[model samples]
Target: IMRWNKNIRLSCAYLFRIKYNGKYLLVKGNRIDQYQPIGGVYKYYASFNELKTKLEIEDEEEINFYEEGDLRQITKGKYLEKFLDWFDTKKNREVTVIRELIEELHIGEISIEQLIKSMQIEYLKTVKEEIKFSKHFQVDELKIFNIYEVRIPDETLAEIINNDKYSLVEAGEINKLCFMKKGLSTKISETSKYII
Candidate 1:
């Protein structure tokens, strides 16, 4: 019999597919070093401190500065199924895309009302990265991402963001493997293609 470790790393994130003119919007990645969709790991509120300890979940090894409390965590493998059930309850952890939308898009100066009126979004699909041993992190990680499509009714944001921080690439070219940078094209992150 093949024996596996009874340890797991669970993570969940919300990603948005913000498209315009037949191209998808991608932001330069800071963590893995390539353009990626706009969204990040879910965060849990401090009120769940008790459950956090019980599950033995901790911050991901990656450096994070966002402040809420990283939901990317480690726990005994035996708790994996149980934890997922709890997550579905939508208790204690973040369940909205608003935080990431505002933060990633640099949406400030405008109230939530403005933000809401400017765009339309709906649930798209869930991309599941089942439990697997990550050689880089040396932990078995299980990740789930809820994707949504954000459609801007006007050019409000497209006109505002005129910087290199964001890049719009054709849908067909997204998986072409590389995005040009500084006149030289380098390989893009594989995760970006999974969204399609």
Candidate 2:
């Protein structure tokens, strides 16, 4: 079951899928009739550790599949809580707009080579780095202007979109679960300009 303080906002999940032609993303196809990722938000718990534990359990009960961890294998930086605090500006309220892009959607391990192949762009140089302009300003950067590639399998992407196995539920209330995936676009837009 999921639980959260009344003040805490729900986390959002966004799933990206490969195109049917096996090239580029299927931007127009997957958007809900309402538009965007087919998932919604649920309230957050008191602590990330607690939330992580509950997430694994919910994944099993809802999808019959258990994910090993709550946070994705992105390049490490500040704790998620800090990011939430910074974004929401309400210290008492924990609001995390989590983007759940599936690595399996691309098939094979996530590698620069795979991205290059999938993007279908010739490269002469590639760069992966943790951009840190200052102690507080930091971000994960993956550049493939040249000399790098990555391939994302279409079948893998389809499996995620077609399965309909995952549920976006609250951490404290299981009943909070529902099949809603619309609205709040301004709040959860893909671009970072809106985050501020």
Candidate 3:
């Protein structure tokens, strides 16, 4: 069963352990040197009613019709406190994961469908609640890093890397993926342990 952290904050993020053929997919962006899983920070939005009022959305049905892109645009410049909400609900978390898999990872619909079918939630690390202060903002984060692994065909895996904004790294070069050790301490410490 999937666990939802009621205290999820905007500073919190998700990362996938997309495994295929003894290798895991780690991504490095054009700007960043560190290679990490394909995921991003979760954004909060207003309640359906509040969003409707703020966006001047009329039809009650249309109020809940916003897609991921639409939601981002509509919520721009809005205070998180005024609209912040958690994936406290199971359905909300599932939807967020689906969206993240598609949007952030660039996983195709067919591949994503297959991947979801094989996903199993495994608890990897749990950091106790603490106040994190940055240069611009501060947040109390009770971060829980979870791992979800799925196997895919070699061809499909190649396609994912070639077609997406990510580059592939060999399983032997696990150290390139910075957060791997932080999250998957024991399971990924030795390449032999994870590659197989």
Over 168-195, each residue of candidate 3 has an lDDT whose tens digit, in order, gives 4455556532333335532222221232
Candidate closest to the true structure, highest TM-score: 1
Pairs that collide, model 3? none
lDDT of 2: 0.28
Ten-residue region with minimum lDDT total, candidate 1: 1-10
- Model 2 per-residue lDDT at 178: 22
Looking at model 1, residue 109 earns an lDDT score of 54
Per-model C-alpha RMSD:
2.7, 16.1, 10.7
Candidate 3 deviant stretches above 4 angstroms? 1-10, 30-33, 43-45, 48-96, 105-131, 135-144, 170-196
lDDT of 2 by residue, 1-196 (tens): 0112211211222233223443222222232222222222223344545534433322212222223332221222323344334324433222322222323233344544544444432222222222323221132321111111223455444443453333222222222212234442211223111111
Cα lDDT for residue 193, candidate 2:
13
lDDT of 1 by residue, 94-134 (tens): 88888777777754355556767888888988887867898
Lowest lDDT 10-residue stretch of candidate 3: 1-10
Alpha-carbon RMSD, candidate 2:
16.1
Q: Distance (Å) between predicted and true CA of 6, model 3?
A: 20
Sort order, TM-score high to low: 1, 3, 2
TM, every model? 0.86, 0.23, 0.45
